[model samples]
Target: MTTPADRGRRGKDARKRVPRSSHAVWVPPVDRPDAVAVLERQGRDRLTELLPIRYGRMSASPFAFLRGAAAVMAADLASQPHTGLTVQLCGDAHLLNFGLYASPERALLFDLNDFDETFPGPFEWDVKRLAASVVVAARENGHSPAKARRAAQETVAAYRATMRRLARLGELAVWYQRIDAERLLPLVRSDADRRRAEATLTRARRRTSLQALGRLTEVVDGRRRIIHDPPLVEPAGASDAAALRKIFSDYRSTLSEERRLLLDRYRFVDAARKVVGVGSVGLRCFLVLLTGRDADDPLFLQIKEARTSVLEEHLPHGPYVHPGHRVVAGQRLLQAAGDIFLGWMSGPQGRAYYWRQLRDMKGSADVAGMNPGALWSYARLCGTALARAHARSGDRIAIAAYLGSADTFERAVTEYALAYADQTTTDHATLTAAIAAGVVPASPDV
Candidate 1:
């Protein structure tokens, strides 16, 4: 087995090839429209009827636009000088994507909650994506450019600090470390921030499967069934339901024997094609409702389609042939504790999907409404969370050495974030133009 010391030595050797100071440069490209076009093409395979809703959400603001343009940004990040230090990336890492979720022990843990675009890639790619998000979100919240830069800098700085701290620890220690809800309280800067965090946690605790059933389903002749919400949450056709059952069975085989036994108690009742998130709106996402013991005891599972990661187009080919398997593997590799039902399946026509609980104490940051102080504090927390994740999969010692004690990497990343934020605004305008010219279809009703 490769020991932690061996990994640290390897990390030190890597710094000799790519110095940490080299991270501080950004070269703006002239051919940005091509990247924008790539994003438009990515949406081609999605559900056509929901394309309007996807575009409508993306067109709301530059931050929202950036969230939907992961493919575009992935292409851009690949062009930069990468260190060749690979980690399982949260390819679409952004301010709002990190959240609170229940771990196996029923504790609320704060970490990266979205992994739709995960793939093995350079560690810096995740950092740059996150820093750019801070800038974009700050702009969307009407904060000054100086505050935005500060927020970005704080994020990078926190990552640097956390990585440095982790580099000195044993590999097992790093792997075992986690940021739970109680630990997250110290990161809050003010009393108002504390109250907001508490409120969010309180709300998340109540967002259970039974709660979702109460809100989303109704009793028809004493039988509860999902309500239809056109273009958002609607019943799957008979043919699709058959395919889904097959996929669900295949997914069950991927789980452990214990989990399978636990799952066997629940009987699948109904499923709906649900529209979710800015980028994933047009994709095939199903909310499956299952009941155990009685109608009062419900379990909600989400089966989301997984395509080849956005990063895969730019990076080398991954080991897994099935994208669903790739997503599950990446999530397991990075998360300290993942969902018990985490599994993958191959569906009809070679479509791939991963399954997990729909909601169990899940909560996310509201970046668009955050003040400067709150944004700064949130950036630090996200940075710390990200560093721990990277340390588990990448060379923390080498990354820390490359970053150093000085503010060199932080300044460079902040500069890159500013430039990228500008590019995001320009790209958002391109999308808006496409919609206005009827080159792209969009709906406001969503």
Candidate 2:
């Protein structure tokens, strides 16, 4: 095995490909499409009827537009210089994507919770996505320009610090490290921050399957099934259920023996097409309800459509032919712990899909309401989690050495983020203009 010192030396060599200071520069590609075209291209694979809703959600705010424009950013980032460092990127590693979720051991852990666009890509791509999100989120919260810069700086600083620390530890030790509520509380800057974090965790703990059961389903005609709410949750055709069961049986084969045996106890109840987040509104996503032992015991699985990652256009192709397998594999590689029932399957029409618990104590920080101080603290937590995730897949020693002891990389990222934030605003305005001209259909009332 290579020593940390050797890895450090190897990392220093990366400066030749992309000098450390070169990272500070931001040059928009001349061939980049107008924002409308990017949005149109992304909607091509989506459900035609739901594309308008997706546009509406994205048009709500600049931050919302940034959230849904991961592919657009991916194309831009691909044009930038990189040091050739790669990791299993969350691909869409925005601030909201970092959250608290229950592990199989029932521990509420803080980590990257989204992986729809996960793939191997330049490490800086994830960092850039996160840093720009800080600025966009801060601006949305009515923070001052200085505060936005500080938030971006704080996030990258935390990432640097965490990576430096992890570089000293053995690989196994670093892999075993996890951040839970107890570990996260001390990082808070004040009593109010602690209370907020605790409150969020408390709220998440209450969001079990029972809570979802009460909210999303009701008894109809002596049967408990998902409720139909137009443009959000709706029933599938009666014939769809049997086909899904057949498809799900194939999903079961992908699970471990113990998990498969455990899952055998639950009987399928019903499934529904559900509209989810801003970026995923049009994709094929389903909420599958299952009953175990009795009506009181319920399990909800989210089956999400998986396609070729946005990063795939820029990065090399992975070995997996099934996109669902790529998502499952990337999630396991980046997350410290994952759902017990995490698996992948082929859809009825042969599209790829991956399944996991829909809402197992899941909670995200309310970025819109955060003050500068609170946002700074939250940024640090996200940076730490992101560093840990990258360290798990990339050479921590090398990346840390490249970052060095100073604030060079952090400052550069802050500058890049500010520049990118301006670009994002311009792009968002283009989208707004297109919508006004009826070029891109959007319905806020929906």
Candidate 3:
């Protein structure tokens, strides 16, 4: 077994191959794939009718474009030299991807919520994506470039600091680390921010299956059923519903015996085809409503199709062959606490799908209009949460050694973030221009 000193030396050795200072460099290669073409390729297997919604959502703003363009960014990152310090990356670790969710113990925790693109890769890839997101989000909030750079730097600094701190701890101690929602309020700098944080937490706690039942279902002819919102939330057709019911047992089989027993308590009520996120817009996603004891007690499960990670194409093959299993395994490995219902199974047409609670007190920060100070605080929190997650799956001692005490990595990542933010803006323009020229079909702001 390698000692701590050996791991530290290994990390230091990586620097000679890819210096920390090299992270700041960003010049899109002349033969870089067209951003629009990449999006087109990703959408090929997705629901064709929903492709317009994806394009429309992505065209809303530069940040929105970045949110939906993980494939594009993955390719860009792969082009650059990296530290080669591998971790199970939150492959699309943008600002909004980190949020609050209820752990099995019923405590709310802030962690990475999206795993559609999760895969093992260089740790710096996740950090760079996160830093670039901070810059884009800050710019969208109308902050000065200096403030944006500061926010990005703070993100990397917090990550480096947190990783170093975790590295010194025993294995079990590091494994138990998490950012509770209660701990978030102390980090706020102002009364208003405190109130906002409190409000966010309160809102998250109320976002339970019961709340979803009221909002997403209605009594139709004295029977509770999922409400129809057309295109976005429509009743699954007979064939789709049959497929879901047939695969329900298969999904349950993937869970532990206790979890399966708990799931068996709820009777599947109804299901609907739903449109989810910007990048995941066209993917096959369904909301399954189930009732426990009686109609009043409810449970909501999301069955989302899992595809090959964008990072997978750039990096070597990971351990899992089943994409859904890969997502579930990655989430379990990285999260300090995970949902009890987390599982995966093959679906109709041999597509891979994962199952999890639809809304277990889940909430995301409304980052749209945050002021500079607020954004910086949020960015730092995300950074810390990210570091905690990486420490769980990666070599914390090695990563900490690679980062060192100096802010060289932070500064380099900040510089790269600013440059990539510019690239994101250009790509956003390219997408919107394609929409205007009728080169790609885009439904208007649905």
Candidate 4:
């Protein structure tokens, strides 16, 4: 495990090497009988028990199947020999998770979004996931494997090259900043792409507190209310409402004294159980809207269900994980700008995750709908953003050293992406069959 001080130190101190003779640790093969058994056992269809499963499923559409595909691929890739440079990885590093967002200073920056499977594991784990997603998403968008593979190689190449570049620059440059969108655009290939990037930037510009107010709070009967569509109730139930308030009350303790003081400016205004994300369909996720003083002064917060990371059960662990801190700690380590209101607390009702700002000009690049030219642009962005995130938590030099200059790493990831994509098709088939047999009832909508 890396200490805060150890992580802060320059160079090799930040990263630890994982032995890679193909025999250092036992990584399971997903195609093996045991691995298949584990997936089925872990898989479920109940809304709560299956929320993660659904999250994975919904995340696997024409535009985005890669995010939901990580667990399946992780099970497959874990069976392979890796360089074992374990650092905190976003776990799911698809292009969609890389998006344009406004930094606190109001600068439009791009960064990693999802981190549920984040853990200190082989950095390549993040790479393979990104590459495979590039392929899967590209194929969905009608790109040839030749194009997709090249795009995948581009992603692997960018991660390796950037890490090496940052490694040479030393720790300060890696930690003190990120590759902003302006610096990022020149890497994209097409005129359509440059235009699309500009449009996303335009959207990001439009994401602010004032815009956030429209999506979260609305005037109903002349009183402001957070929108709700039953089952995902707004305001919660009477007694449950009070308990929800209590949860937020305790959540304040997780923040620093300084942040807590900043939060004093805002008071809870409205809260409700919001059905969010395809995967989180059944778990309890609450949306809390806050007001600074008057009704027009608004802010939004989300309290989601935090479950055990899939990485916890499979990979060789690094840090001691207190269940209460899983989401918060993992997120801070994995994302560049996590929710300022991000905090964690556990209750007898089970674990609930609290975060702020549900929407802020937040939108994903549509990979499935993208032209082949745009897929390359999108893949590179996700790859670079993910690498930037890893460089923050671990030593870049050692990692860049392990990756080397050859196409060896890119070849390895491309090979793995193909293998895992096959495994996902097989698993998806099994899931499809399970639904057909009525073992897992198919939602007519799905």
Alpha-carbon local distance difference test for all models: 0.87, 0.89, 0.95, 0.65
| lDDT (10s digit) by residue, model 3, range 347-426 | 98999999999999999898996889999999999999999999999999999999999999999999999999999999
Q: TM-scores, in order shown? A: 0.96, 0.98, 0.99, 0.85
- Candidate 4 lDDT, tens digit per residue, 1-446? 76433433422332233322222222334446443344445444224444434534543443333444455566655666555566787766666667766555656667886665667787877877777778777777777878877888888878878777776775566677565657546755677777776776777777766787786567888777777755445566667568777777678899888878878898877778776654345656777778887777777777776665666656776474554476578777766666676777764366556465666556556565688777776677777777788888876666776666666667767766655655555556665555566555334333
For residues 210-282, write the lDDT of model 2, one tens digit per residue.
9999999999999999999987898876766777888988899999999999899999999998999998889
What is the C-alpha lDDT profile of model 1 across 312-344, one tens digit per residue? 988889889999999998888878789998999
- Candidate 4 segments whose C-alpha is farther than 4 A from its true place: 1-66, 230-235, 318-320, 348-352, 444-446
Global Cα lDDT for candidate 4: 0.65
Residue pairs clashing in model 4 are 28-79, 54-279, 55-279, 60-65
- In terms of lDDT, model 1 sits at 0.87
Higher-TM-score candidate of 2 and 4: 2
Cα miss at 423, model 3 (Å)? Answer: 0.2
> On a 0 to 100 scale, what is the lDDT of residue 341 in model 1?
89
Candidate 3 displacement at residue 184 in angstroms: 1.7
CA RMSD for every model? 1.7, 1.2, 0.7, 4.6
In Å, residue 260's CA in model 4 sits off its true spot by 1.1
